[model samples]
Target: MKHIVPVKWLLARLYESDVVIVDCRFQLGKPESGREAYEESHIPGAVYLDLEKDLSAPVGEHGGRHPLPDAAELTVKLGKVGISNDTRVVAYDDQGGAMASRLWWLLKYLGHENVFVMDGGFTAWKNAGCPVSAEQKVLIPARFVATVQHNLLVEVDEVRESLGTGRYVLVDSREAPRYRGEAEPIDRVAGHIPGARNLFWAEGRQADGTWKSAEEQRERFADAGLSQDDEIVVYCGSGVTATPNVLALGEAGFTRVKLYAGSWSDWISWQDNPIAVGDEEARNDG
Candidate 1:
């Protein structure tokens, strides 16, 4: 039920019954790299989940690049991966929990509270000299039901409304350059939403790629002007990377946090939506 699990704990329970380890390593540009890596070698008994194919639905014009997959369909997919209501799930990726947190958040949104993201991700496992295996695991399928939590997500309309009213603290979780519109390598527009403050998702990690402690995380959010009671909504280029910020917010004692699943990609999809460029002060008028 822990939000983050240490690599040592994961290794200790690597092959335990009712425990499922998911490998979520992925590259945004090369979608096949994650599966290829898993095929070569992964934690013993670990199953692979592709960020684009397994975790997200097909990309469309409006829902950003990595949209949430259908809940019923995702439930079936989880069942196929041997995840049930009672199974303890642990997900990890090479890039900290950037990709893995998506799976962690998805499971939590689906009402599976026993899921956790492996701290430091797969890199930590390798660094610690844990054993790896190339043999694929085919688990006995179990039934998984999606008990969706609608409150964890905010639609485009909600984001727009909140922006106008300042009712919610909107956070843009992309890098500073992307938020400042200095450079955008992805998405059509090279800017961010109006009135959004930049809180790069990478700030949640330590120099070694592990997450900071809850005390340190709280301090980080405080430095960013966030408080525990603020109605915070986080978004990024797409919905994927922002999950780590959501996890960080939760660890920092924030209760009213939600993910803007459609993010900036979906925002710019509409011709009417305004784009903000330059410094945060200038973007305030966007």
Candidate 2:
């Protein structure tokens, strides 16, 4: 029922008729490797969803590298994968929960509240000696109705408009180097959006790969000077990695948070948008 479930929790419900486990393991560099790994060996009875093909829309001039897929199309895919309105979903990945959290965020945005991300991902399952199989699963399709929750997402225009207004707290979820414009392996622009503070998504997890406790998450955000009531807007390079931070904000007791689904890539797509390099300025101003 929680947003992040442990391997033991999933192992207990592995065979439940109402539960579906999703394999969201993806590599940004090798886009096909996640499917290859799923084909090679995955959690028993788990289904695979490609980040590029299934989770996101085709990239155009505007919607960033990984745009949100159409709601109708996404729910249709969910139906084919045996996810009905009431069916519970548990998503997992090897990439430290980024890919899995993307699915978790999508399901939530589609108004599916029963979805959850598996903590520590497939590696934790393997380390725990859980069963793994190479056989692919095919389940009876069911209707999945989507009620889109538009509040969970913030477009580039909204992000731009909120700058220097203090209406929303912009949190850049990229690594410190990328946030500081020191290194950029992806995206043409190196700097981050003006008036954005950096909070690397990886900090939400512990050294052992498990997510930190609620209290720990609170401490993490509090150290970043974020309060529970702040209207936080999170973003990453192409909107994939920011989901973890969004999830982390929820765990930290923040009820109001939104994801900048276009992220930096989309932000930079508009040449007129302002970008800030180095560290954040003393004030949150565009």
Candidate 3:
């Protein structure tokens, strides 16, 4: 199946027996806002997945602000949400795919290829005048067996070794200000990985919050000096927003891309890892 589905297409298949819609709306400051919004109204039959509760494990001194949930626990959660090996899952959020892509990536990492992000997300669905419902769905539980793809994830040590190696391209998918160390709203330390290059995750979206075309995405990656053969590793503040960049890279036809699951939050958890600030040019050559 496609990586992304348009609102119209999803509307047409809203009630299909094999489809599972997930509402992933969330705010960093207001963690409960997503569930509140989902309760008020959402796409019909869509289940809610909390970013903090459902999508991530409790944060500790390490592993960034958001850590991957245990595979067995995730399998249980998916089963409870009516997702099975054959289910076609669609996830969405108001913030483009920033929140939803995490679920999409997690599903793929669990070896579920039928998962997709709703292009343009809830905003587009609402604007299109599609029907919304407050009725909660009570789905019969289905067993979801997860076969983890371990190669899709990387650790801090691996990232450190890859720096300036020319064999790997370390990508920081946070905003410009955060990457340049001008301002840090979340993590303790400002700046990014020493040799990492900045590629804002939001660049994957258009002005209307819709994803850019594959052609445009290819151009964006080309402008960043990336080729199809680059061994790319992407990370964001807490490993959340980076998933969208991961999706974008895949859409652009890049074959080898992995997620730095701990991201900057986990990087700064230990003081020994060097952090860099200022313009991209001022940083160490990678």
Candidate 4:
């Protein structure tokens, strides 16, 4: 499944036994807020998914705040959340696709093929005037199968090689300031890959905070002179926000998009690795 399956399309499949609708709306500073809003009202039968609590492993000084969860524990989370091998999972968040996209990537990384992010997210759902409810969902335990798909992800070494010849198109999906290295919000370093292009994930959305049509998104990425079929890779602070880019790229009909799972955080951890800050910065540290 491509990254986006429209909200209306999701409404139709809400009752399918094979479908698992995960509400991934979350806030970085206010971790409890996502659950509060979810408990207040959510799509009927939708289960709340937390980025920091559910999607990530324990945090540490070296690893970014949201470290990748171990597969053994992830299987347990999936089982409790009603995600089975047959599940077609759908994820959404209020702020564009920020938190939801993380699940979209995690599901795929864990080798589940039936998952997609709700384009435009909950905002689009409300605008579309869909139904909402305050009732909590009851889940029946289900077996969640997981197998790591390493090809779906790349790392610092892979990034270095990609930069060696500019053969890989590295796309930065952070906000403008972060992408331009003008602000250091999360990571200690401030900059982007030398040959990378910025497409701020929010730009992939509409004025109403919904994703643009697939065709429009295609044109926007194309404006950056990216070839649709190239070996395109995406990244953000810690392989979290870039999931939207992977989703948008798939929606834009790109068949070979990949994510740098370790992302900038991992890149910066390598002491000998090269670093570039602003635009017009040299492509290689050497």
Candidate 5:
């Protein structure tokens, strides 16, 4: 049960006794908005995980906008929300797997193996004609153990070293415009990492806004010069959107992927850090 659960699977699991459904709907522009929508209406018995309050630490110049929360804090938060070792957790967000993938990554990082991302998120669920329940579900607290896997993440130095050696396939999950140094709406500088190939996470989504099948995802990875097994590192503006690619690659059967959690935004903000623009890219700094 390490893979993302399909819409049909989740619809049936809605009635499972120990299932934990978390609504992770969020907007990058207005962070508080996701919770409001959840409070208004959500999957019956679903609880909310706030991106800022529950999922991330406060933004700073050093850390990206939504830095990963402390493992201890997240364990407490998940427990307070009634998560436990045996819980079958299902998470979803509005942007297909955008925000939901974040929680998926977090849960995996914390060593929760059975967690699933609701394919297509809430929209897909509603489109499937599943019933929505607004009542907040009561929870009985249970112990959640978080054994953070340090290897799942990569720092900037690790990326820099992998560059000259060609030891890893660096990938930018941002759109081509942003990855091409053409249009950057959020961050200060508008370019991607040097030598990193483009694999926009949005491509992983279907026209209807749900993840494509695992076979389709595997093909996309192969098209990008990525095989089912490769030493690959993924990144987006920050660490958030990149998780979708992480999920996609994993779904595609690549188990060696790692995330540069402090991605472009974090890279550009540094004075002596490497910067690249246009089609030709790589490091200019020592």
Candidate 6:
């Protein structure tokens, strides 16, 4: 709950000048649908940020499918949307917090700590019968300064070096089928990085599409037997879905959580990286 706010909380601050609401609804392979949906209706005073265009950079050979946006460019985009350093940003999406959490993680990586993901997303808002508008507000651009947090990210080489070393716990946030190499619809190669544990990001949320409580998130991660002091690096197909798990880990009181920004896609780009099929087994050797 530290990084997520409920619908009622956002509704109360709907008109606050300092609180900026962002609509981050995105669907894979149907990128335009999100904007089209926003054009139809969205929370009043909300601006839309597209996942593939605004949130991610152009794909490269080795940087994964959705690379992290350039900080300077993203800062300009943020400023254009009236997000300054002190602005309290609330990001929402209908994808069960996955898309919204991406914006939240990006803001935190940019050294803006006041951002949060809206719990239950757009569905919860509409179900509550809150005010919706089709009007888009054009506001004066504000100044956004970016102070990048380098330690919050890990490179492919770093992940490779730490394999089987217990230096960090690499968490695969994809679904069980993807992790087990049973199905791979998006990426070129199947399976996950060797030594990585599967922790499907969706588990961070409840069956009702709402996020779990802090204690519940802790219990969800408890199966991993992780300690608060352990170094945790989370990743998914690209680097998007893993964000929810990163935020969830933080909510679970893990102090040293980080993201492997390139994720599985980037890891497989080299072709020389080791890949493991089937479930990663627990090691009994000391």
Cα RMSD of all models vs. native, in order, equals 1.6, 1.6, 1.5, 2.7, 2.8, 1.4
Candidate 1 lDDT, tens digit per residue, 52-154? 9999999887999988899999999999989999999999999769999999999989999898899998778988999999999877999988899999999
Off by over 4 Å in 5: 280-286
Q: Where does the lowest 10-residue lDDT sum fall in candidate 6?
A: 277-286
Question: What lDDT does each candidate get?
Answer: 0.90, 0.92, 0.91, 0.83, 0.85, 0.93
Q: Model 4: clashing residue pairs?
A: none
Q: Pairing residues by index, what is the TM-score of model 1? A: 0.97
Candidate 2 error regions (>4 Å): 281-286
Q: Tens digits of per-residue lDDT for model 6 on 58-162?
A: 999988999999999999999999999989999999998999999999999999999999989899999999999999988769999999999999999999989
- Give the per-residue lDDT digits (tens) of candidate 3, residues 37-146: 99999999999999989989998888999998888898899999999999999999998799999999999999999989999989899999999999999977888999
Better of 4 and 6 by lDDT: 6
Give the clashing pairs for model 3: none
Model 4: lDDT of residue 13 = 89
The TM-score of candidate 5 is 0.94
Candidate with more favorable, higher TM-score: 3 or 5: 3
Clashing pairs in model 2, backbone N/Cα/C closer than 3 A: none
A best-first ranking of the candidates according to their lDDT comes to: 6, 2, 3, 1, 5, 4
Per-residue CA lDDT of candidate 2, range 129-237, in tens? 9999999887789999999999999988888898889999999999999999999999888989887889999999999989998889999999999987799899999
Candidates' TM-scores? 0.97, 0.97, 0.97, 0.91, 0.94, 0.98
lDDT of 5 by residue, 1-286 (tens): 2468878898887878789999999998987799889988899989899877888877788656677788999999998888997888999888768888998889888988888898888888888888887788887788898888888988877887777687888989998889988999999888877788888999998898878888899899888778756789999987889999999888888899998887887787677777777764333332
TM-score of 4: 0.91
